[model samples]
Target: MASWQEIEREFAEFAAKVRARFDAGTNKTIATVRRDGAPRISGTELKFEGGEVTFGMMDGSMKLLDVRRDPRIAVHSPTLEPPADDPGSWPGDAKLAGAAVEVEESPDSPVPGAGYFRIDVTEVSLTYLGVPADHLVIESWDAAKGYRRRVRK
Candidate 1:
């Protein structure tokens, strides 16, 4: 797994694009494993600070409990449709997959039992569709493989 800092250091340009997409909106989506091993989706807010991706959850929240029991997580940037007049202008969608590690809460934590987690990214990807006329593009980065690009019609 790699930290956000490591991803930025190795794939600076791509990382920037991904970060921009993630920051384009206030709410993001996170996927976690439920106790029955089924997938659970939750709305979340993300913080990219101090070269780390962090998030908080209310105490005893199901999502928080899920992460506590199983740290694996996948976070998706908010989805935005491309304008009809400017298909290529869309920022595309970004995804980050990793394991969450519980971290100590700051003194200013809003909730008494709020849980904080730092994401240790294992994979990051951006996907663009219909950007270059009937083509789809995907760019991905990983700790072991660095960066890769793929295209489809």
Candidate 2:
């Protein structure tokens, strides 16, 4: 098993991979749960700066509303490979969950629903070709920065 620090490093590396694959385009998806218990999922651009994941939304978007009402989210990265209709030969996918908070918008940015929502990721699970791995439970989170490795009991 990897130590907490090593796991953090792996997460950072994985973030870099995601950024390279999606940050420049529109491929990432954001899923938020509403206070009324509805689930809202939509594609959004993901930006990583100084190790924090930032995603933007229009002020009036349902996702934004959902996050505001219930600031919990699950972000998913679908299998990169083309999905096979058959259950076999499928690629892996990744998902992370955490608490979310609204971020102040940039004064100069003109994107309409340009406000950001930052998620303080608390749990992460990686599925390799549909095999679920052990869940990583976050011991602590920092929205201003990121997460610190938790000491193993």
How well does each candidate superpose onto the true structure, as a TM-score?
0.94, 0.61
List model 2 lDDT by residue over 95-150, tens digit each: 66677767778554657665676667765554333222223322323344454433
Q: Number of the top candidate by lDDT?
A: 1
Query: What lDDT score belongs to each candidate, Candidate 1 first?
Result: 0.91, 0.58
* lDDT score for candidate 1 against the true structure: 0.91
Q: Measured by TM-score, how close is model 2 to the native structure?
A: 0.61
Q: Per-residue lDDT of 19-59 in model 1, one digit per residue for the tens?
A: 99999999999999999999999999998888999999989
lDDT for 89 in candidate 2 is 42
Candidate 1 backbone collisions, by pair: none
C-alpha RMSD of candidate 2: 7.7
